[model samples]
Target: MELTLTDDQQELRRGARRFLAAESSPDKVDAAMKTERGYDPATWQRICEELGWPALTIPEAYEGIGLGPRELYPLMEEMGRHVACAPFFSTVCLGVNALLCAGTEAQKQAHLPAIAAGERTATVAYTEPSGRWDASAIKATATRHGDGYVLRGHKRYVLDGHSADLLVVAARAPGSTGENGVSLFVVPATTAGVTRTWLPTMDQTRKQADVVLDGVRVPADAVMGEPGAGWAPLARTLALAVTALAAEQVGGAEACLELAVEYAKVRKQFGRPIGSFQAIKHKCADMLLLVESARSAALYASLLAAEAVEALGAGGPSAGASAAFAEAASSAKAYCSEAYFHCAGESIQIHGGIGFTWEHPAHLYFKRARSSQTLLGSPAYHRERVASLMDL
Candidate 1:
């Protein structure tokens, strides 16, 4: 299938680019990074109102724009390019994906509309102090009390946890262990027993928090999907997240490459532009190749994910569809992470002393690239997944 963006998609990209350039200035980025919440609430609200970004992926039936992955993918890429500091990724991509995939009709009706309207923010709390992303790694316990569940556990590195109005938490129920006992619960952040503390991270623009759930109580209806069936939905959500992240990586890599290229063309050495030198030219060429390759991979994986959703709805796995999507997703994540890291490092190297200074934007991209590489899973982790999928 062709991967080119439609005219409308191009327009969307241009619009996002314009908005980021106009609103997300260097000063704004720096200020947001130092803030307690990692972003300005008013600015975030403006982003939602201006771009309709938070609702891009939500279906029209839920008051969203009703677009699919193909349309949403480019917008994510633009966000990455600007290193736009916001909780859109945490709430819209991850949390919304979980709800859409696993939530019952009542759950969807209750939560999705608010999210689509950008009136509320949400997140999924799964990683604990151990930092494992597996469903089986959950240690938080949710015990049945009367007709409800009481949660008692701590989660570390919960993105936007401090600011989220709602949280989808993963916990082990009663006597269940491993994947069999894990369940997802939706808890209001304002619940009496829920406490949140912000965590300092290398990428300060993106906030993370440590959450303490002390006998947090919720109704049984809060459980997403069927009890003990959390793994399948979580896995599917992760695959989609990997694809979105890959698109983000592509945007970041392209931005770094552009910055490096523009700098090289203007900066002179030996009475000649630095870009004229073979070393710099080779680096730029490599960066371009890497970005293009990453774009292809990200787009392919996203299409595969969309296709998988469609096929699953039609009753059975489409021959090799899941494996293809997994492999492409892993390949995109691993390759783009490594590629962006290299591009960022090289961009800095090309800039010499100025690159090391705090004044330059290269370091920001570098830090984001490094941090994002380890977000869902590291390059090494994804490579292992790719290999396992291939049975090699």
Candidate 2:
């Protein structure tokens, strides 16, 4: 497929860059990170109500702009470059994607409009304390009770969980086993028996929460897709998640490379710019290669993900095409995660002692790189998935 950015995509990139530069500067990010909410709600509202960023991928039928990942990727890249402290990813990418991929029409009608209107923040509750990413590893249980279901379990590393208005949860339903037992549910975060606790994060800009659902009850209609069949939709949603994250990683890597190159050009050592030196030049060259290659992989994966979303559209995909998209997602996630971390480390090295200080934005990107390496799943995890998809 063509990995080149179209005219409209380039415009999106420029608009996003301009907006984020003004609104999400390093100073602003630092201040927000120190706050209880981790991001300014007013700024988020501006992004949604004014820029319509949160509506990028939501369907128009739900009062959204009705775009896809092809349009969303460049915006994600811009957000990554600025380390934007917003719930855009967790809400738009993770939560919205899960709903669109699995939620019934009634469910989407209920939540998507609120989300698109900037009235609600959303996140998915999937990972447990065990930290396993597979559906079969889910331990949260949903038991049938009267005309509803009672949920009892804890989900860890839930992005934006503390403030999210809606929580899309994955839990094991009674009378099913293994992957088939896992079911997706739409739970209001403020519902009785639901408790949220903020987690200590390496990257304060991206807050994660521990959500406990202790005997929380919901109507049977809370189920997203068909009962005993959540794994398929969740898996597809995760593939899209990894693809979107890869795009972000590539963007961050590109930003780190830019910072290093700029610093090397002006930071003189021994009466000459460090960039003039062979060692520094080689480091920059290597970083450039890593960033460009990762960008290509991320872009291609994004295209495939968008196409997959369009083609599948809740009904699921043909086996071969699904396998192909899964492989692309795994490859992009594995390579981009490692590439971003490498570039971040190299940027620090090129900046010497100054980059190591907390004052520099370099450290923020470094921390983000480290934390994101395992946010959805580690590079090793994605690599293993790639192997499985390839039948290696």
Question: Which candidate's lDDT is highest?
Answer: 2
Question: 126-156 in candidate 2: lDDT tens per residue?
Answer: 9999887877679899998999899999999
lDDT (0-100) at residue 187 of candidate 1? 87
* Local lDDT at 265 for model 2: 93
Clashing residue pairs in candidate 2 are none
Tell me how candidate 1 scores on lDDT: 0.86
Question: Where does model 2 exceed 4 Å of error?
Answer: 174-177
Residue 352 lDDT in candidate 2: 96
**Lowest-sum lDDT 10-residue window in model 2:** 173-182
Compared to the true structure, candidate 2 yields what TM-score?
0.98
Model 2: how far residue 178 lies from native, Å: 3.1
Root-mean-square deviation per candidate? 1.5, 1.1
